[model samples]
Target: MKKYSLFQFCLGFILILGCVTWGTAFQNREAFRIGEITVSPGEMKSGYLDVPEKGGIGSRIPFTVINGAKQGKTLALVAGIHAFEYPPILSLYKIKKMIDPAELSGTLILVHIANLHAFQKRIIYYNPYDWKNLNRVFPGDPEGSISERIAHVLKKEVIERSDYLIDLHCGDGNEALIPYLYWMVTGNEKLDQTTKKMALAFGIKHIIIDKSRTKDLSQSKYLGNTSVLLSTPAITTESGYLGRTDQKAVLRNVKGIMNVMKLFQMIEGNPQFTEEPVWIDHYEVVRSDHDGLFFPLTEMGYYAAKGEKIGYVTDYFGEVVQEFYAPFSGMILYIVNTPPANKGEPVYEIGRVKEK
Candidate 1:
């Protein structure tokens, strides 16, 4: 009776092992295909997503894809939407090199530079050819401006292909900002919750839950919001400032991305979340009324009361042309660090913190 029981136990163990092996093989057979490249499991591939120009010449958006040995979720890490946002771009470069396909469970798509035109020309927010901000245009028109065409390609190619996305950013050349994240709270309850979890997992000290409902599609064309509308959970992050590439800021972004990877089970280990992140429900952008030199009275991350002086616009003679005041009590999300300012340009972004 004892010999018979041992034989049965061995037979059961072999069957379980065979099932596990077959499952893994099935997952490996499911390849990640994009732009004429198909990456099988445990493989890493790098290429560019081509964007054609007016003269038939074209530019390419550099990308790297890592298909993990085990099947799980695909996470897309994108940066350099604005040319001057160096930290996030640098982090993506480092991350692509560090991640091993054998260790990852799913796939990671890394776009090192989204706006190659702006990046190469050292332009700030807008693309040089179209003079339009890439971030503001999404699901773009094929026959539109160069910027719009790039946006359309990204939406159809990169964004649509991913299960989740992390759009990384830093302050433009003329701005200083505190590190924070913007998580869109769409009407989709499940997606909103998942995005919130991803935001918290990013390990940022401040989080802004954007709950704005816009009738115009242009108003909601931001990359993060557009991704959410497409049924993908996404989050946008801000870290470095003044167009400077600080290693500390770059490392922070790298670590935060790794944490998100863990949260999605693409990698192992638990995410280290902030003990309590300051949550804000809404934010307002303070724009200058006159073209002049901007003199900020307050710093980034400083809390201000309603009607408090946040900054001022001065003429060439140093005379105050316009005094900017906070419209509501809130924390300073970002501020203009560049001395020069233009009419209708943003001076500061203030967020109303939610009370516990």
Candidate 2:
């Protein structure tokens, strides 16, 4: 072989060095960013993602990032989509305190409160500024109402950045609900399987085999639904109810999150999967036909027969306006336990159990 000159040899070495640098860039442990905060490996940071004021109403989302030392999947835990849901909200704060980045494998983004406006005002279901349900608008409009703007920011900053997501919720102040999770199907077998695995790993016994959510991207509506349509595996979990922040409710939320982190391999320990899962094959959220007071005749987790009177709504003057009944035999997933029931609002939900 002919020997190369010093200049040619130097040029060859420089090219090889450049190629090596470029190849390693893809494997670099880059910092995680949200809003103005940046977190490097083995660090945890918390801050607010400012939502610009529009239409005289604006809100801020409180988030935390626990970035791990080792490379792994990023899992997002979101709570307080409905302000009155106490258990899920309380759980996030506890999680933020417990998880140490030095011991973690990947990042954990905790959206402590997605709707601070509603949360501060103690409002349930709807935002105080726009009266729009924050959960009803996903992939939201930047120039729309305050709730919409909040949703838009979350879609861009939180959901889009996460590899897996968990939308934690509980019964609103008015709603008495049982612990359960939605296993939303996107019709993509692999993706559906991934979501199903997440639900099982969440440790909730009641799992809704729900394929009823919208496939239309424009109206993906729910937070978890938006993530699913965007190709991110997500599950919506419901635990506590009636706005009570009991210790049992709080710990249940905490346990579920911990188990899911294990499932993603972002933390140590095996995921404690549900030993026996109750599959809800079909379900319906029976809506009220009149603005009135609702009296539930059945509690959550109990079975009701077809055409059984599950609840009744009475007018403002205490006159019976409408009586609600079970469409078919199933378990009562949730019901409006409080008196105020609006026309076209959900009164109670029933889930038909699937045969094993």
Candidate 3:
């Protein structure tokens, strides 16, 4: 009897080991098909560098790309493109880990930190010799400044290599955003429609038209014919000014990314979050007319009526210098708390969306 019992125990153990091995194989199969590997920093691909070498102030750029191709759509997610936006980077990191290679149907490419130099110093705005803002430099030149060179490589490697791009960002050093997405206006109806659909796929509550400038170099405005063919549907999102490793913000971003993956059918699971997104066709920049202490009466993400007193600009003596009001009834998407605002500096963004 004892011998028989021992024989049965050994057989059971063997079966369990076989099952575990098969499960591991299944999980890793997608990574194999998609090619899971690191494209070392400073590695040259085609004509652009994968990432820079790490050096004090100017070191190697560490960026990881995880490709999960299950024979579906390709989506590219980028974080830390701006050094100071920590929440988005953490969000992308968590999402990368959460993505199961076995369940994914399409390819997912993740670029952790696009701007490694500024990221090292935790600086929001990159200060290159000839330029101050890396975000403004689109389709950068290979022979330009340090920031431009990095941007140039990104345009070729990640931007041109995927079917869709989700550039994650956060509020600048001075302001906090109400988790929103900025869609570039290409003046093409088809493109605009495609962009809107993609934004909805992310399950974000608000969508804003980034018309603050004439063009955006990162996605559309800078893409030439060659870049255009490589470019896919893209959306730039601001995850508020939450610090890096902020669990709340990270979870929110992960949820948004998962929704998009589900929409693309990259994952077998159903989407866990949904929202009726508010699409703003236009936004007005309410700038400060005089430098003083600005006290905000209303909050970000709140609905404000036209001519409503959103806040007050005051002098050092605590006397009200000027009261800032909305020009039209819209939602307060973002606002600043820093005092002593110079004249013509943007104070708030009022958004007006088409009523559903």
lDDT of 2 at 61: 91
lDDT of 3 by residue, 115-163 (tens): 7666666665564434446675667666666666666676767676677
Off by over 4 Å in 3: 1-60, 128-131, 185-190, 209-231, 242-245, 270-275, 288-294, 312-323, 340-345
lDDT of 1 by residue, 280-316 (tens): 9889988999988999999998999999999999988
Model 1, residue 94: C-alpha shift (Å): 1.8
List, residue by residue over 264-327, the lDDT tens digit for candidate 2.
8888998888989999989999999999899999898889999999989999999999998899
With candidate 1 superimposed using the best TM-score fit, by how many Å does residue 307's alpha carbon deviate from the native? 1.3
* Residue 11 CA displacement from its true place in model 1, Å: 8.3
- Candidates in order, TM-scores: namely 0.92, 0.92, 0.72
State, as a TM-score between 0 and 1, how close model 1 is to the true structure: 0.92
Model 3 RMSD in Å is: 8.0
| TM-score leaderboard ranking | 2, 1, 3
Superposed by TM-score, candidate 1 places the C-alpha of residue 97 at a distance from the truth, in angstroms, of 2.3
Error of 1 at 216 (Å): 5.8
Q: Candidate 1, 23: how far from true, in Å?
A: 7.8
